[model samples]
Target: MFGLQACAKAPTAAADAAKPAAAAQDDGGYPLVTDVRLQNAGNDDGWLMYRRDYGSSGYAPFDTVNAGNVAQLKQAWDYTSEFDMGHEAPPVVNGDYMFITTPKNHLLAFQASTGKLLWKYEHDLSNAGLKTVCCDVVNRGVALYQDKVYMATLDNHVVALDAKTGKVAWNEKIHEQDVGYAMTLAPLVVKGKVIVGVSGGEYGARGYVTALDAATGKEAWKQHTIPMPDEPGGDTWPKGAAETGGGAAWLTGSYDAETDTLFWGVGNPGPWLATLRPGDNLYTDSVIAMDPATGKIKWHYQYTPNDTWDYDGTNETVFTDIDYKGAKHKAIVSASRNGWFYAIDRTDGKLIYAEKFATATSVTGPDANGKMQTDPALRPTVDKEVFTCPSFLGGKNWWPISVSPQTGLAYVPTLHSCMTIKGAEVSYKAGLPFLGESFLVKRDPAFPNQWGSVQAIDVNTGKQAWTFPSELPWNSGMLSTAGGLLFSGSADGYLYAFDAKTGKVLWKSPQMTSGVLGVPSTWKVGGKQYVGVWAGWGGASPIWGGEMAQDPKVKGIPLGGHLYVFSL
Candidate 1:
């Protein structure tokens, strides 16, 4: 845990002076959000990545439309992704152009103001990729650096495309799909290097993040999440299983340029069942800060050690400066899938404090070291169903969380459900990967109303500031603005606006879509600011096929595949 004296310092670097930063050419325009600091993964211009910024705050401080007349917001334009598994691409906006991808891997370049199609690139990934993907087929989005766009396909290839023309500049293979590896996360570009991580935590693949020369597509660095035998953190896992230990950094990570540290949140261990691999899984289910220059780990803080609940720590790591206990502190905050909101000292990767943000009945509290209080009773077992709060699905899934330095509040989209998990364990064999079976059980009486909640917490106090209730899961990422409003979407097809100070529902509109799982982004084009979000459903909710499928209320609403933009 981060002690009282462990205050973080901003990584060294002057603010981008209207030029793209890093290894790419300085575009002489607004800097790119190469790291994880902005919502839409960059600045407020157009969302370049999943978080809109490297901090993964999901918050945009721009406010052309404010509380005074947010109800007047009207549809600016709409773009249909044309493939309907799940529209998760966050649009990357530069000047008047916006580029986005669909769940089926269709990349489209559009006029940001009118949604006029510039060009589209559809990738025909091999059918072999279908088998490698554990869940539904989907792409998170793409990254923009220099004059090119970078994206990883489900077929396990990283392709660089010219930004002005949707043409492939260069394509390279980071991993092959044959060994049960699929690349779905967005590629991150920093300095002159493009960094990407492999997915398939559920498929028992050796996870690693590879850095490539952005210009030549040459290998720069590769940091394996799972350690080799005799290497550091190697003794934690069973002999040869380290390769399949599953500490995938599948989601987008944040970067502190001043410290030269890249912060990545790792996923859960493989095979789900804890009895297979023993010892505290070092890098898995933890946040590791690495040097972007050499990919060397600087510091790490584990959220769940030897996790059995399938609680991956692969959510967004939001970086911000907060006034804590009358002292200014550089902090990294994350709303973890493990049902806890953690604030840590980013500079040294120290756990500052953690608070339960949702119904987490598995553990009582953190131990003296600030690690999660592991409950032996909640550990998975064969044929014996143990009810666990926050389920494997978690108190919070991958929907992005937002932090407003203006309001001093962190907004989180949360779930309040639980599941009964029975772990049927088996031995791990090469090529066979891992064998474990688990199913969901819903027993709580308050399961329906408790399904979703949007909470605003005071970062300084580590307490709830306000909350907005939801009839469905809070499955969408949040966006906050200087206009004193918070914007978030729902699986129920409603896009909502709430007061930043009070959790008052100021306005609501039916984006007319189900299961909106992507991060919403906003930007100004033609001097008129507009808010945008991809409204198509699909993600982990289908895998369980439990409450969301059987719930008598929401079963009728079909999935969606469209993009919605709004303006006043």
Candidate 2:
């Protein structure tokens, strides 16, 4: 029933007829989001992009919903999209309008102050092979630039829509859906270009990042994550395996205005087994910095070279200025999937610090160069089974972390699971799963009942300030506010408010339908502060790590498709 209508135009007349006169108050005029607006996005007015701003701090400066008054918050409004797949997109707010995307690539615009539907645009992917998608049919969100909204579809198409009217302006096919390429990340609008990345590392597709003209949808530049034989990191990969190397830039990247650099994390190499593709696998499990204008790699740092445990480096590279080694440094930090937290100098890609944040059994620690001190015995072979910590679900997945400059701490949502892996013989096939390993994911033996945690790490010292444990793995991302509160949702259907200084749960409310898989966002409208998040329980964990999903802690969570908002 969801896909029955190919392109259902929003009934504008009916929506206008239902609007209440009292809800039509003009706080300000809707203006085009320019470079200036993006740089100042953290100001108390609106949440402009996926992680609030180009820095990906995920922190809001609004204090209306501070620690003292957050307990008095109540649901202001609720809206259900009724499509019922994973609702992972964070709502983007600009002036009085808010935009959000649902599963299957349905973009909806609504009045920010009042829950009035402005317009809706649903992309039709019925003819595309839905089964080819490695994960569930999920979308992260949309980007707003000059009067247009940009969203990447599940079928590997980047479409630009007129922001005011929900009309398609241009649609460009970035990758072939038949060959296991899809785009689920929200496009990042940098200067005049819309940047996006492809998905499907599990199916052996070569990954790439492309930039397109924001106005005409014409490709401006493209950068392949996997390099050829003569490329810089080519020697790290086997002779010809670089052709299908799996360094997927599947998540949205962050930008540094001062350096004119774009930071993106790459995913794991092909075939979950390590022996099949020998060597460090080049840049697969690495973070790459590039020049946005030329799409040329500036520098790269590999986190888990020749990663065999399926540890993807596609986590957010949060940019912040920290006091490291008793001196102030411009740093980019990440709570990596390999169960370690790393801090690097963004200007030169030099390692500042690296430490384990979760139960990592495969890695002992970081060496002088910050590369993991890997245990050779932990590598699984075709003839032997090996148990490794921080399972394929990762110590942390694509869910975002919030960094509060006010508190000088990074709030990380983490998974505390492990896996037993055994290699199997397999051959490469395009459009088919190239993973040559069998794995059973489970919670760590020491803490079999606990599966998730929210860790507050002091970015400067690379030390965890405090940790808040969860019974189930966190499906939601994080939001930090000037009120000294950290907001995050969970697989148990509750959106929690925590004290930023201490790991104390101040308040929480049940979402009532399903787990919260989306990130939380904050914005101010009509002088009132509001917090919002999408309630839906679907993502890679449920699809790839089926055993972990069926664990007693998370088994009762149901599917959902509703947007929950609260205010004082």
How does each model score on TM-score? Answer: 0.91, 0.94
Candidate 1 stretches greater than 4 Å from native? 1-44, 429-435, 441-448
Report the lDDT of model 1 for residue 2: 9
Candidate 2 residues lying further than 4 Å off, grouped into runs, are: 1-29
lDDT of 2 at 470: 84
Kindly list the per-residue Cα lDDT of model 2 for residues 188-278, writing each as its tens digit.
Answer: 9899899998887888878889999999999999999989889888888878788778788899999998999999989989877889888
Distance from true position, residue 311, model 2, in Å? 0.2
Q: Give the Å shift of residue 568 in candidate 1.
A: 1.2
lDDT of candidates 1 onward, in order: 0.75, 0.84
Ten-residue region with minimum lDDT total, candidate 2: 1-10
Maximum-lDDT candidate:
2
lDDT per residue, candidate 1, 256-354, as tens digits? 777778988888898788887888877898888898888887778888888888888888889888777787779999888888888899987766778
